[model samples]
Target: MLVLVICLIIFMTFVMEVGSIAFKLTGVEPSNARFQALSALTGTGFTTKDADIITKSKTRKKIAMILMVIGHIGLTVIVVFAVNLPQLISSWQLIIGTILCIVTYLFARNRVFVDKLDNQIESQLVKKLHFKKEPIEEVLLINDEYKVAEVRLETECSLINKSLASLHLTSKGILVLAVKGEDRVILTPKGKDIIRKGDTLTVYGKIKNIEEILCK
Candidate 1:
């Protein structure tokens, strides 16, 4: 009984680790990726607006498919084991063992263990795309009418060496909220703040106009 319980715990951890790595490779941020991994492995199907990052991508969809398949298989195996357990043990000790197993399983899912194990596992995986970091939830801080986006600035763009005041981004209905450089973040930057190549610009504006301004 104890051996089976240990096996289940290991299997669950392995599944979540695979899910987390898959999410990171697809360009997801660390915290959100971990949550999505747990959601996927448990087959919770949690309603998440940010889930588009995973569900909308072809590569991420492949990971989600594998998780769903494994989740179903694990459920089936648990059901079969529960049905067959009575034949192996007939005494009241079986019931006590099951109660203890449930308690142990709950303890094994403790957040501290999960977080530590996740961090250790992630340290082994490569974090390659620093420039492609996902935007934080700054969009939610503003009113419903305004939206925020992070645009990665490339060298050789015409906007190089220009300050917000010189470019007059406000004239085009855009507001530069912040600039994230290689080592520091300039928040609510003044008009005199220069826009450097390789900086990430967090701007507020309509989706269409901002898309045109950045995607051009």
Candidate 2:
């Protein structure tokens, strides 16, 4: 549900960008149907070829952003798994390496085993990629689970390029644990530090409430 909502919001943002292109570049009036608006905006060489973004450089650039976002979200699962699998396996390096010859043969010869193992890897990969429920250490130290989680962000919310305080999550029961950005990961953020994009915020709070605020 959380992933679906985030993807849907991203989709809607793309659709709106398409609508803007349709109005400005294609000279076609915007419509209530976002799907149609996207088709029109992309100028996917539909029947209305004149309206297609290929003819308009600016619209084409905007379309590129949509494509890039789509590529990122769609391929994230496969790419993340491929990149992280070695790291996870390396954690058991000594034992695994000792039995590498047998394991390699077993993994390669049986289709069923290979498929099942890949599925397991994919499942674990997605679970790790989900940023909603953080680990215990990443959360604030509170006496009880009932306590509201508050993360005081020194940097901006990387995705939205805004300050931590502007996220307006304290009212929603979320706490900031750490601010991690370029060069360093600060366990506790100071007021003046600027939160930039690509920073991983370690946050804590009631799992459900925190998920609702951050994932949404």
Candidate 3:
């Protein structure tokens, strides 16, 4: 019975960790979904600020429901076993089991493990399970090959008064995604968007190319 309890604890930990990953793949942000998953697993209802976040989606809701059931069952079994046969297990078994449980918790919380595991899980789910999720590229655009940067227009720069169309920032391998002026922020600035001195341009593209063109 002691061994069974230990095995159940490990299994519950795994279920919770997997639930966290599933939440992320469903388009929830890492920090947010991780909390949601852990809370759901422990039957602790954290604020419902993102409640609809998990409940609206069929897949996420299913995972959350399973975690809730498993959490209640797991807690009940632990209590029943501890009360009925607390002395049956040796002290060493308790120490080792507790250590393992702690280690598993830390491992699951490590960011590196989360990222690598997410990639592997994402690949398998997409290829074999036909999992449909947002592309990672959409979530994070700045990667090894490209980056986003901000450039503040200097008063002396040649492009001070030019419109975006005339400057051809995109042609130079840089795209101006937004413009931050003294009072307002314009998203997807139009071609006729005038470049004003002191305006900050948020751009995305090859870093070196952007530096050569927009960063001038």
TM-score for each prediction? 0.49, 0.29, 0.54
lDDT of 1 at 183: 81
- Which is the leading candidate under TM-score? 3
Tens-digit per-residue lDDT, 81-154, candidate 1: 66666566555656666776787677667999867866665555445322222222234335545678766665
Indicate the TM-score of model 1: 0.49
Error of 3 at 91 (Å): 4.2
lDDT per residue for candidate 2 within 1-216, as digits (tens), equals 233333444455544543343332222222322343454434343444433423344544454455545545644644554556444554455454446545555665889985675455435434664312221221233654543333322223333466666765566676566776657888876544556655556676776665455544
Question: What is candidate 3's lDDT per residue for 1-216, written digit by digit as tens?
Answer: 566687787787667767777776665665566688888888787776667666667887887888899888888988898786667888777787788778878987899987797788767777886666531212224876678665666567777899999988778887888887888899979999898987777778886676567645
Q: Which candidate gets the maximum lDDT versus the true structure? A: 3
Output the better candidate (1/2) by TM-score: 1
Clash pairs (backbone) in predicted model 1: none
Give each model's whole-structure lDDT. Answer: 0.68, 0.47, 0.73
By summed lDDT, the worst window of 10 consecutive residues in model 3 runs over: 132-141
Question: Which of the predicted structures, 1 or 3, would earn the higher lDDT when compared with the native?
Answer: 3
Cα lDDT, model 1, residue 203: 86
Model 3 quality (TM-score) = 0.54
Clashing pairs in 3: none
Question: After best superposition, candidate 1 residue 146: deviation in angstroms?
Answer: 15
